[model samples]
Target: MDINRMQDKIIAEFENLATAVNKFSYFRHLKKISNGSQPMDPEDKNDRNLVTGCSRKVWVTAYKEDGRIFFKADSEHSITRGLVNLLLKVYSGHTVSTITNTDLYFLHEIKLFNYLSASWMRDFLSVIQRIKSLAIVQHLDAAPRS
Candidate 1:
């Protein structure tokens, strides 16, 4: 699905779900869809992909293939894992331009930002920035050297 459709679907899913329990359950569902069987390894969990400022360790990795982006992530906690999974669901398989230009306004519409602490918010933004930076680097690398 396109980014717009995915955004709307995510907003609707979160808005439709009631209670933190349900929300977390839905996030796990998304994680299952994204992560499948193999998850990030212990060795890969280092300073490179680790999301700083989070209460728990979170690692996110991104790559590009045939102009489309892919992401893999894992977190020390279930809730954060779910969050990363949700983001990857929306972000992965898109072009660098699409990923970079997209706005994550649905996060606010889902009321997730409201419940986040200052540190969590910083970590959340860091995840987003990491994703965009990866896209930027990939785009630049793919560009023809003039």
Candidate 2:
């Protein structure tokens, strides 16, 4: 996928998400959503509900229907939950190849990656690698299914 197109699409989609929360707004939302909510289930996984590595344990459940990927995810940390929502808002409904091969540089473009802690940076990269890895796996899975 083209970088410009990808970024443009992300921006558009995020803008449409009502509040379009950035880090601050996200934290605000997280604080509100942190009222002892249970984590989402990983047992009910479908084809796309997977994330490989993360500092805070996370479960991403995805379903690609009608050429749109719908994702439901949860995590232990408030910030992680927020991040999951952010990721789903963009990558949830896209095809494995559309997600994997794209130049979807999300961190900087999203304007939140810049404020990340050094430790969080490592976690962030790991999570991203996990997503890419899964996308690649699914792409291969879609190949012949032999």
Score residue 54 of candidate 1 by CA lDDT.
69
Q: For model 2, what is the error of residue 16's alpha carbon versus the real structure, in angstroms, after optimal superposition?
A: 12
| Best prediction by lDDT | 1
lDDT of 1 at 65: 91
lDDT of 2 by residue, 37-62 (tens): 43566575433444554566666654
Task: Evaluate model 2: give its TM-score.
Answer: 0.62
- List the pairs of residues colliding in candidate 2: 69-93
Model 1, 1-146: lDDT tens digits are 89878888888877666655454565555455444424877777889888766677888777779988888888877666777777787888899989988988778777777666687678777788888888788778888997
Please give the clash total of every predicted structure, in order: 0, 1
Candidate 1 TM-score versus the reference: 0.79
Model 1 ranges with Cα > 4 A deviation: 19-38
TM-scores, each model vs. reference = 0.79, 0.62
Model 1 Cα shift for residue 131 (angstroms):
0.7
Candidate closest to the true structure, highest TM-score:
1
Question: Which ten contiguous residues of candidate 2 have the minimum total lDDT?
Answer: 30-39
